[model samples]
Target: MEIEIATIGGFEEVGRQMTAVRAGEDVVVFDMGLNLSQVLIHDNVETEQMHSLDLIDMGAIPDDRVMSDLEGDVQAIVPTHGHLDHIGAISKLAHRYNAPVVATPYTIELVKQQVKGENKFSVDNDLVKMDAGGTMSIGPQCELEFVNVSHSVIDAINPVLHTPEGSVVYGLDKRIDHNPVIGDPIDMERFREIGREDNGVLCYIEDCTNAGHKGRTPSESVARTHLKDTLQSIEDYDGGIVATTFSSHIARVKSLVEFAEEIGRKPVLLGRSMEKYSGTAERLDFVEFPGDLGMYGHRKSVDRTFKRIMKEGKEKFLPVVTGHQGEPRAMLTRMARGETPFELDDGDKVIFSARVIPEPTNEGQRYQAERLLKMQGARIYDEIHVSGHLREEGHYQMLDALQPQHVIPGHQDLQGFAPYVDLAESQGYAVGRDLHVTRNGNMITLVE
Candidate 1:
């Protein structure tokens, strides 16, 4: 049996996450994602209003070139989670290989809503929902299993692909959050079980997003404290209280809702992306916000909802909207630019429960939004947020737990993965042998 793996994208970069795994004639592709930086840099596409196909057409993201190269040999395409950086490209390219797109239920629903909003009909790829601990057969030569893990989002997992030669474990973009608000914690027992199996893991692809940080990622519970403290610090205001955060951050939203409840106000959701992602989470039983909360999933609906809320007295409701990165078309930016009917009143609170995404386009847009918010006499709260990725000590712990024959870093550049390389060296794993540093489009083979 011949085992071959290639980084279609997202090897030495932060986004456009795709990887092809093949053994004998059966092949499986993981995470056909879009590069947010590439899209913004090349075509000036904003994340909130991004259309996947447009990025593909402009050469801003990868097409189906990787799967197409395998001809009809591809058996399945899987996304480990629902984050845009992991599953954004599935709708644009999953049909090319005519393979099943397997994932947890929430991830599938989120992808479908994203595709539908783009006015694109669903593709032919079958979406099969697999439970966290269940296994599914991709073909005669490959079996796929989802091992539950914790991250910022619900239903996140590390996929273990059992092939003819050996197993390949994909551990990209995860954290070991023990006190997650939405779901259960990481199943370390199952992970150790896989690590100790006879065939074991021939290769392990791990996330290097926080390789530079020196410790385990702080829990979502810590972020909840920050958000709650920020909200409590604000003085009593009679006007609207608006917040902007990552649309997929259901935990943050839950915390905000709890704060709103404590402040004797109803929570209203604005912006299409925010409502869509939140709806998927709710449907999967991930969060349990109050039923009285109102949500607007369309631009026109959001505008009308804001007008009604203003007319009825804004203090009665706490609005959580989009534009965390200041995408111009999102609700917050439109409000800031006076394109929407809603106006920020004096003493009103506009909280940004996220960080600036450190990209040129995002920097410019965020700057514009802040200026406009100040001009409108709104009190702005910024950086009341925390990261979702693991840090250096966390990486060390994961490496120690799932001791594999080889490690390949994902979702980072060479400079970003340097700390991980050092950690591996200290653990007696040398470069080019047990530690594999590869770039995008490079293929590596595992031999027994």
Candidate 2:
């Protein structure tokens, strides 16, 4: 039996995540995503008029040319979660293969919404829903399994491929959170069981975005505590209370809603992505918000809603908007610029339930947004959040739990992956041997 892998993108940089794994002759693709920085750079370009190839050339989407040779051998395209960084390119690239696009229900719902209003391209294959812990046989020699994992997004999973040679697990974006607010914690028991399989795991490919950090990542529960503390400290303020974060973060959204109710403020969700993910969460029964909560998706509706908030006094409403990364067109950035009817007074509070993504593009965008908010006398409370990636100690624990034969560190550049390499080496794996180090477009082959 033979297995080969390709890291198409999201290897040296942080986005456009695509990976092709082939067991025997059957091939499976994971995470067709977008490069946020590149997408932001071409912000004014109309995607509907651009060909997929042009976007690929512009670095907006993953270049699938690495798998050109296996064009007809592809079996499936699977996205681990609903984040655009994991599923954005599906509508643009899933048409390249006749394979089904399989993912959890929430992810499927989000993808359907993404491709709904566009005539640029359509999904040529069926959208199959496989909940966590479900398994599907891809071919006579290979099977796919979804192991539940916790991350910023709900219903995220670690996809594992079982082949005649051994099982290869793709855990690119997850953290071990025992107290995730909306979903069950990391399925460590399943991980340990896979580790003890007779064949064991052939290779464990994992995310190393936080390998340099020490200790485990704080749980969503901890972030809820911090948010509560911050909000309580500023509860007596006489102006608007606006909170912004990743719209796909259902756990954080739920926490914010609960906090809003606790402080006697009506919860009003504003922005497109906010309504998208929150609606999915409600439909899937992943979270339950108050029935009377106000939500708006379209621009006109958001404008009308904010206008009413301004009329009724901003202190009476807890408004949640997009642009946590300070994206130029996000709702929060527009509000900072007085594009919305709502205004931020000198003592008004703006809670950022997120940390800066740390990429240069994100850093610059955030600086400008904060500068604008400060100039308006808005009290900025940033970084009142917990990361959704496993820290160094958590990485060590995951390695210990899933004692795979070989380790492949991904989702980071060389500097970010170094700590993961050291951790795997400490566990007796050898670099360039059992512990493989690779970059985008590079293929690694293993045979048994």
Candidate 3:
């Protein structure tokens, strides 16, 4: 049997993650994602109006012309989670393939939503839902399995491809979170089991997003506790307070809503993405919120809600909004710019439950948003969050658990892969031998 892997995208940057693994006559692709930073860098760029090739030229979507190099039938197009960087390009590219889009239920729903809003392409790919602990046949000699993992988003999985040559485990975008707030823990137990199962993991692809950082990434519960403490400390303040985070982070949003009530404030979710993700989660029964918890997405409804919050007195509510990274059109930026009905007074608090994404564009935008908020006399509370990726020690732990024959560093550029390479070398894996450092649109043949 011949086995090969393609590093399609996201090898040169933090977003637009797409990879394909070909096992003999069958191929399975993982994550047809969009480079959100690439799209956001341009002003007034409507992705809906743009074509895939044009977006690919702008580095917004994966240039999948390299797929022709792999001679196999694509059996499945799997997205590990619903994050934009993982599933954003599905509507644009999935229609080009003849495979079914297989994913966990939440991710499948998210894909449907993305496909719904797309107008340029007709994505008529079949959708298949599988649980985290489920398995399906890829071809005559291979199987696909999904292992539960902890990430910033809910219902994330690490997909493993089983073949006669060996097992190829796609370990992208996860942390060793044992006590993740909303879902099951990072299934290190299953990973250890897979390491000892059958051919014992031929190639292990890793997410190196935080490999340079020391120690392990903290559990989501730690951030929840920090949020509780922060809100409790400011309990007595009789002024408006606002908080923001990744709307896809259902656990963090639930924590904020809980703590807001604990501090005698009615927490209301405001913003389009916030309403979309939270509403989906609630409808899917992944979470339950207070009966009266308001989630307004449309401009008119959000504006109406803001008016209600203002009319009911700013001190009575906690607005958990969008724009954690200060995206120009997000609700928090609009609030900071004083374009919303909500007013900021001296000593008013603004809590950032997300760390600044380490990109020049995001840094600049966040700085400008903070300056605007501060100018409005809002006290900024920042960095009250934890990363969704594994740190140095966590990488050490994963290496010990998987113990694969080959290792591949992914989800970061060459410089980002450097720290992980050093860390892998410390564990006795060399750069050009068993350890492979690769880039986008490249292929590695493990067997032939």
Candidate 4:
């Protein structure tokens, strides 16, 4: 048996993540994602309409070609997590391959929610939900194993595929968070066991997002302290207290919710993305926010909710809305632009519980929003956020644990993946033979 690996996307750049592994006649695809930077740069498409390939072509999705060669031989489409950069392209592109989409429960639910609004391209692919530590056979030559791992989201795992030729592990987005606020810590023992098993890892595709950053990533606990400190310094105000962050960031959301509760206020969530992701986390039994929290998906519904909350007053509620990156269509941008019914009052708190994504459009849009909020006399609290990816020391630990024959860097460009190459070399792994740095559209074949 022989194995061939190809980078359909997410090789030379950061988003539109797709990778294909072909063993014999069957091929398994991992992560059909969107390039948020490319999307904004080329198409000028709204974030909500990014699922369409036409808009994607205009720059919303990565420019790499989908694996048309595996259209019929595709066995499964596995998404490692729920981030938009991983599963966003599946509903739009997976149907062509006619394969089952496999993921942890929350990732599946989140993907379903994303495609639900698109009448033209509703998600109809077969869904197989495998819990962490579970294994599922896909074909005669391959079995997929979900190894429980920790990330910003619950039920995130590393996908280990046992193939006829050898085993391949996909470690796209993971962190060794010893103190993850919402879920259990990383399963180091399980990873070690897998490494020792027969057909032990032939190739390990790993995330390179934090390869350049030094040391282990700071835990969610550190972020919680920062949030608490920021809140304590602010005086109580009469206007709405709004906070915007990554929807899948359950730990950050939990911190905000707890802070709101401490201040004698109810936390109200707004926007469909926020509600859907939060619901997925709750359904997966990750965290339990209060049942009284409100979420508005439609404009009409949001307008009504805003009116009710305005009458009830700011002291009664803490509003958590979308548009942390200042996407124009997101709820926070609409409110900042005076498009939403929600009113901004003097000395009101608007906490940006996220970092500004460095893409040019995101920076511009966020700048506009900050100016508007300031003009309205709102007090802005920015940069109360933490990264979820593992840094250099964490990557070294994973490399030490899963000492595979070869390492293929993923999720970032050459500059981002360089550190991984350096790390492997320091461990005596040769650059060309044992270390493979791939680009989009390139393929690597392993022979035994």
Clashing pairs in 3: none
Question: Which of 3 and 4 is ahead in lDDT?
Answer: 3
TM-score result, candidate 4: 0.91
Off by over 4 Å in 4: 41-56, 62-72, 121-123, 235-239
- Residue 185 in candidate 3, Cα distance off native in Å: 1.2
The lDDT ranking, best first, is: 3, 2, 1, 4
Model 2 residue runs over 4 Å out of place are none
Once all C-alphas are superposed, what RMSD does model 1 give against the true structure? 2.7
lDDT of 1 by residue, 277-319 (tens): 8877877777877887787888888888888888888888888
Per-candidate clashes, comma-separated: 0, 0, 0, 3
Estimated TM-score for each candidate? 0.92, 0.98, 0.99, 0.91
- Clash count (model 4, backbone only): 3
Question: Which 10-residue window in model 4 sums to the lowest lDDT?
Answer: 63-72
Model 4: colliding residue pairs: 38-59, 39-59, 39-60
Alpha carbon deviation, residue 323, candidate 1 (Å)? 0.5
For lDDT, candidate 2 versus 4, the one ahead is 2
> Per-residue CA lDDT of candidate 2, range 266-367, in tens?
889999989989988997899988888877899999999988998988879999999899899999999989898888888778889999997998999999
Identify the superior model by TM-score, candidate 1 or candidate 3.
Answer: 3
Best by lDDT: 3
The TM-score leader among the candidates is 3
Each prediction's whole-model lDDT (CA): 0.80, 0.88, 0.94, 0.80
Expressed as tens digits, the lDDT of each residue in 43-146 for candidate 4 is 44555554555745555454435466533388888999988889877767766767889898888887787667555565688888888888987677588888
